[model samples]
Structure formats: C-alpha cells, structure tokens
Target chain A: MINPINIGSIDDIDEGEAKVIPSDETGTGEDIAVFHAEDGNFYALNDNCTHETASLADGWIEGTEVECPIHAAKFCLKKGTALCMPATQDARTHKVEVSGNDLLLYPNVPAEPVEA
Target chain B: MSDCTSHTSEANASIGRMSRPEAFTQNIDVSTLVDSDGGLIDRSIYTETSIYAQEQRRIFARSWLFLAHTSQFKKPGDFFTTFMGEDPIIVTMDKTKTIRAYLNSCRHRGVRLCRADAGATKMFTCTYHGWSFDLAGALQSVPNEKAYPEDFDRKQWGLIEVPNVQSYKGLIFGNWDKDAQSLEENLGDMRYYMDAMLDRDPEGTEVMGGVMKWTLEGNWKLAAEQFATDWYHVNMSHASALMVLSPTGRGPKAEIAATPGRQFGSENGHGAGFPTHPKSRFDARPVHEYYDYEALRERLGDAAVEGPMTTGHATVFPNFSYLPVNGSIRVWHPKGPDKMEVWAWVLVDKSMPDEVKDAQRLYNLRTFGPSGIFEADDGENWSEIQAISHGFVTNNVPLNFQMGIGSERNDGTYPGQTSELYSDAAGRAFYRHWSKQMNTPAWHERTEQA
Candidate 1:
C-alpha cells in the first residue's frame, strides 16, 4: 500500500510531453517521469534511463513509447519495456491515476503485476 | 646552401624546415630533450605533465586551429559545436552571414550553453536559469528581469568569443591569441600542397554527412608526428593491413625503395612525405580516383596533378591533419598527457555523383574510422608507446630518429627541405618547431629565418 501524492493537474503536462516527479516525492529512491502519452492517457516510469546516465523525462514521448535521448533506445511507456538495442532491462513503471482534473501519483506501487 | 634553399628560401616566408629543424629552439631547455641536431628524442616529452600543460598554453592556444568547413554554415543562424584544445566552442553564422566562434559556456553561471552537436536555432536558451543568447552570442533575455540588481548590464555579459577566426580556401581556423600571425603566414608552403586536395574539382569540397569520433589512450603528438612525417612506419606497422588491402603485389610500397619520394617540413612545424611518381597511389581502390584531371587542368597546371606528392598525408602545426586517399579530415583534440579524442570528418567534392560520394563515405570509414584497419594499427602503436612510458626505465630512453638525417636537401624539386624518401627529417623539424613555440612566451618576440 502506498499514499497517493497529488502531482498538480492534468493541464501541467501537454500531449506528447513529460514532467519529472522529484525523487523525494516518489518514495522509491529514484526519480519518476509522469508522461502524458500521445494516446491521451498518462503513464509513469522511472526517470533514469537503463542504458546510460540520462533522464527519461527529457526523452521524446511517442504514441505509447519514449525514446532515450542519450542513445535513442525506445521503451514502451505502457509497460516500461525496453524496446530497442543497447537497453536490455525494462524501466520501472509507477502507478498514476487521473481523478477528474487532478493527477494523483502512487509512490512505490507497480502499475502492472506480471505472471509469477 | 643548397639550390632548394637558395631559390625557394630567397622568397621562402617559412623558417625552420626538414633540413634544419632546430630553427627556433636555439636557446630553449626543451631542445636538449628533442636533440634534432643529434637525432635523439627524449621519451619524457610524451608523458610529462609540465610539458603537456605548457603545450596547452603555448601551442594549442596560440596556433591557428581548424574549426569547421564552410558547408555547415550556409544559413544565417546555423551553428555547430567543436573543441579548441578541449575547450568546447560554438561556430556559427549570424544574421549578417558573418562567421563567428564563441565559447560554449553560458556567461551567467558558466554552464554549457549548447548541448547539441549541431543544429540551427535563432536563440540558445540555457537549460539552467533560462538565460537566453541570440545568434551572435549576445545576451538577449533574462527569465526574471525584476529579480536582478539595477546595475546588471546584459550587454556586458555575452558568451566569451574566440579572439581570432579565419579561413584558408574552404578550411576555417580559430585562434585564442589575437596577436598571432595570419593563417596564410603560418601556413606558408603547406598551402601549395593543400591545393592539390582542395582545388582538384574546382567545385570545392563538402564533408559527407556525420562525424566519426572516438577516444584512445595515447599522447596526441605520437599520432600527429606520424601523420606529418612518419610514413616510414606505413610499410612496417601497417604491413598486415596492407596485405589485406593489396593481397598479392607489393602494394603502394610500390617500388618504394626504387621510387623517388620527398619529405618536407615548413616553418610553423607543418610536415608532409610522399613519393613523387605520378602513378603512386596509396589505396588501389579505383573509386577514390573519380576526380577529372583534364577539367582541373584549367585551374591547376599539369605539374600539380601529374606529380601528386600532395596526395599523401599532411599536418598543419599543432593538431589539424588530413589524408587525401580516403578524404578524411580530423583534429586530434588533446585530452591529457596520455589520451586524445579524435574527431574526424569525411570530405568530398560537391560535384561528385551520389554513388561515388557514398563510396567515399564507406572507404573513409573502412580505412580510417574508429574501427578502421589502418586506424587500429596506428592506435595500437601509439597506445603501446604511451603505456610503456609509464615505466621509470623506459621513460628515460632516448628514441632514435636518425633515418636519412644528413640527406635533407633542396634540389628545387618540391618545396622546403625535401629530404630522402625515408627520413626522420620531418619529425626532427616537427619537434624543433614544437620546442621553439614551447619556449617563446610572447608572439612578437618569435623570430623567423626570413
């Protein structure tokens, strides 16, 4: 269980854009990137790129994927899946919910649970 | 005096050369280490921190350094990033179409201003603090104008500008010292050789898309000297690569012992070595020879193309080096005493057909790119030399440079002190001019034989 932290309104991030949620607020000891995907839905992933030392929040947000700016390794924003070469591991995804106009971020909570 | 000096040096604006490399190091302490007079080079010059720091101050900072080709700056607000001795710089063409180079650091907090390798933008807004600078590097906007003190003047704080910038033909160069001599004066006889590569098509040249960059653990001079003067190593060091390049025949060691070749060193430490035979081609690859010699005969005389000494390797003083065979232009940006970062660009004639241009790109990469065959051979030698310099015993050994020492002559065949086919005359000249520049603190007090 995790406490929901209010991360401004949905209007704070525009379509095809992303905003960085600071590390201290994430409770996971890593920075979180709340991306407003082009699909008109918001998704959250760990900000640090798994390939090299670069912030994923500063990367390009495509339809449902984000490309790492450092080496252009694309990752699936929906499942935080690394979708290209040079990046083998998946990015950690965080749970975020849009309630009316307010965007709520759940710290330390996984967005999806995989099969054991 | 030989006829080469008598005839050429009568009008020779360039001083010390292959024959007499110690032209400017008459009174310097570094001369003892690089005893060009006796043909012995001290090993410490490659690994000493004090000598390396002095090189940064006197050599890289004062010499005319290569910037960027003119093709990258066709538009008004176009810009690109390059380094001047490890100091990042932005070369741009402002609204007036005037070319300029400025330090890449933001004036406000000294953070890097432009992070992109290259792109055109009207304004560069600092990612930190959002301080904006216009195309000419003028401070344009401050995010919070009201928060600043009343006396804070925006005009006073602009991106620091490189003191001098100029171009030779299409090649642009920058200098940190304003008092340094003109690029032409520094280039001297080396320009005559450069014309062979740059003036071939009359359509001029353009760098093929993309730059190839990589790092190696080696002192910068180790590579620069080889490019400028050490073609003698090509047969030995790159023997395996040559075998792969030309399987059966002797390759471009083509009658090397039997052929007539000349090694030349100019006033400002520039050096080149090439065989004088008209048909002596380094790479047997025919696609690289697409230049129309008859069409160029109108601009350049028959002698220029016929005797293609300019077809070989050459280096301009400190670090700018180029090879005509694969059309690779590169600058060895010195990282420290034992490391260098190589930034290379593949240049081609603008009028070349698409396929030929593509072939040039491939050949350029296959031969000299990061993983290139010849590049690998060269890197290993430089790296091994650097690694061995770490030993206290090996560090004190004086390397032999006595190949064709007394053979430097001027028969009026090529240019200044065209020594024997295989010689360290150019290397001696290189270290001589290096010691001279390292010793002279003031630009004006520096003397030339002329």
Candidate 2:
C-alpha cells in the first residue's frame, strides 16, 4: 500500500527550483528532492546521488534536468534517468501528484520499464 | 539479489585465454603471489628480488605501458625519454610525423643514447661511440666507417624498436610484446571513466609543467592499488592535512567518515572513487572551482560535463593513476621489489584560463606533489609497511581484504564489478588481475595462435 504524504502547497516551490523533503516526512532514511521543472511539471527523486553521497537538492536545476553540485552527474527531473558516465544508475523516482494547492508524494519506486 | 554478474567478462574475457609460444611458457609460476580467494596478496611479492624479475618479464614487458602524451611530440624530430620497466626508451616523431619508440641504448657497446629528458633533435649520437641514429631510429651515421667491412649492414643496427605503439585520446602507450592487444582492447570499460575525466570537453586536455619525480621505499603495487581502491584511508591518512585546509577548522575526520560515495571496480584491475560532496570555491577552495559549467555545457553537452566526472581518484591498471578533481596524474614506476620511483604530472583542460590553471597547479602542489602533505602521509604509510614486511613473521601473515565480499551486487548502474563506497571489492579485483597477469607464463605464450 502506498501512503501519500502531503509535503507542501504548489506555491511553496518556485519555478525551476528544488526542495529537499526531510527523511522523516518521506518515511525513508534518505531524503526526497522535489523539483519544479521549467517544463511546467513536478518530479521527485531520492535526494542522495547514486554516484556519491551528495544531495541533489543542492544541485543546479535547468529545464528538466538536475546537475549534482559535487560531481556534476545529471539526472532528468521528469524521469530520474542518469544521462552519463560516473553515475551509471538512475535515481529512484518518487510518485508525485499535484491536487489543487496540495503537493502529494509517495515513496520511491523502480523506474518504468524502459522502452525497447 | 540483483544478479551482480561481471559485464567485463562478457566484453573482454578471452584476453587471458589465448595460446602463447612454447618458449614463453617454459617456466614461470606466480601462483604463490596471489591467494586462491584473490583477497590476500603475499607480502613477499614486495620484497622478493626473484618475484620482481618475473614481474618485469611478465607484467611490464607484456602490458601496454604509458609512454608519452601526444602533446609532448607535436613537432617532427621531437623526442621524450621514458622507461618501460627498467629499460630506458625514447619516443620520437620522425619526418613523416609518425611517432616511434626505441631502446635508448646504442647498438655499439650498448651505451646510453639521448641523455636529455626531452628535446627536438635531428639525430641521437651516442656519446661513448659516435654512433648516430636519426629521428626515425635508423642508423644514419657511424664514425670511422672505413674500419667496417663493406658487407656490414648499417640498416640492421638501428635502435631496437618497441613492437607496438598506439594512442588513445591524447595519451600514447607502447608495448614490447609484438602480439599484445591494441591499447583500446586493453583499456576496455575503463575508457568510460577515462573519457569522463579526460574527454569531457571537446577542447581536450594537455600536460603542464615538467615531471616531478621522487623515490620511495614501497612496493609499486602498494601505491598502485591504493590509488585504484583505497578511499578508506583518507579520513585517517590525511586527517592533519584536512584539518589545516578545512574552513570550519572542525577537521575532515567526521565529515569524511560520514560522507557517502561509491567505489568502482572494473576489468584489468582498474578502480576509482568519487566523493559525496563536490569541491569548489564555495567549499573554501578557489582552486577547486571548475570552469563555468554553462560555457563547458555549451561545448561538451549536458551529459559529458554534468555527469559523474568529478573523480576524486582513479587508476588505469598497473602504475598509471590520476586525481581528476585536481588534475594531478602519476605513474608509480617500479624501481625494485622494495622501492618505486614516482613520476607525476599536472593535467589541465586546454581551454581553462591562465589564473585558474595557476590556482590548480598550486592546489596540486599543496596536496599531491612530492613534498605535499598527502604525499608525505602516503609515503610514510607505504614505506613503513615495506619496512615491516622485511620481518619474517610479518611477511608471512596475510592482510585482510574481506570487506563486502559476498555483498557485491549489480544494479545495472556502473560498469564492471562494484560494491559499497568503502569496500575492498576493488582491492580484491586488483589482486585478482595482478595474479592473472603474473601467472600468465610469459607475454609470448599469450600471443595469437598460428
């Protein structure tokens, strides 16, 4: 069963900005990073980078991709796919949905089976 | 279990299975140097003279060793002198702009030729016996030609040439084994990491400053393996340096111990590590700040510049290693069983600004140069271990390397075999590959079958 927790209102995050939801709120040991992409959509991923112990919430966000500040590993905010070397594993994406003014987030899940 | 199967085996398994010449396979047994589990390596391999000789024959002679960077020989007649094992070699560019390497010894009396480290020369004339060889390593002139018989062939007396010479990206490598695989084949999956650090920008990279060399009393493998797989030592080995360099004055022990990172193991014994936090000006080090990411992104694309490129340390099996974050590259040249000659060079992007390059050089000097704090710390550790291994009781004991053994699982994330950030998986892999190379009879035995 998926427990959807309300993080904040949609106005809490600015366009193209990212916020780190603490682990306590996400019910996971690792924090969750919520991104308000320039694509006019919301996405969430595990805050810690797979390549290292960096917080993706502290990374640079442009368009729909986030670049880790520590090693520069880029992850797509829309799908949480690792787009290059160094970071070979894609970030685990969290289920997110916006309901009016409320932003609801679910635990991270395996990525959708990539298309052949 | 995520079926942590080794991808390297699928791509490059047959490299060790090829048949070799009977002459090369006559006698050599390195089965004693490595344990059956591939976890513990025999310490005597570091102090035994006989084992060192075997290493020269099987490892150095057969492997694609680093020779010179392509930027070192930009003009015709340019030459750089380096070593393949203990044998001195000179890499030169001939009139045709083809790069070649030759034994730096003259054919006559076996005198050392080309005493200079690097220079543009039309020909190399042996000081002991005036036997001159052109840039192509051909015997162009010989003093007192009248003394020789008319039938004597000067063509046959050219400098002994390295059998294979190849370049990947801008780094040139040479191998003495004629049947050795190409540099690309030897590199395998390691190329991905190399490209991430080296080929990120289209402008390419270049070597800066002359070589800084120093000798240390340590086994070459100690230094090589550490660079390849030892991130666990940083918190303790470099505690004092971090304390001095830390902005908060809180020291790096707790921060480093708590930080999360990944340790990567690859085919052919290559290993690398990445730090959890990125080093930059905001972290109180102006020298660590990279070039403007936006500008680099424009040229290198988002994936190349902004992906797992911040490598804190890495090794290309054997002695070649580097720290991508600081652009410091080194080769742990084996001097003997108990000693190694370290040759390090600073690398920087060709497009970085002068101030940034200067700052970067200063950073390298402060952190990894011969007298640098970290270098001094590592030197002491390696040397003390070598000294301790001289004792019979200690030498017989096996070092522990069982960290994250059965826990290794692949998430289809990185290439090659991998474990946790602070694990001995890479170390085990290094020993495994070392054992394989050492036990491979001889270079000729692994040549392509007729």
Strongest candidate by DockQ: 1
lDDT of 2 at B308: 38
lDDT of 1 by residue, B29-48 (tens): 58678887678999988998
Predicted structure 2: lDDT? 0.75
Q: Candidate 2: where are CA atoms >4 Å away?
A: A1-116, B1-28, B36-38, B253-256, B278-290, B294-308, B445-450
Candidate 1 wrong stretches, greater than 4 Å: A1-116, B1-29, B247-254, B284-289, B295-298, B309-311, B442-450
**Which 10 consecutive positions of candidate 2 chain B have the poorest summed lDDT?**
B1-10
Candidate 1 per-residue lDDT over residues A39-92, each given as its tens digit: 898889999888656678877788989987545668998788899966889998
Interface RMSD for each candidate model?
10.0, 25.1
- DockQ of each candidate's interface versus the true one? 0.02, 0.01
What would the per-residue lDDT of candidate 2 be over residues B249-347, giving only the tens digit for each residue? Answer: 767546555666567776587887665444421121554465567765665455334333654578878888888767788888899899999988888
Alpha-carbon RMSD, candidate 2: 26.4
A49: Cα error in model 1, Å: 32
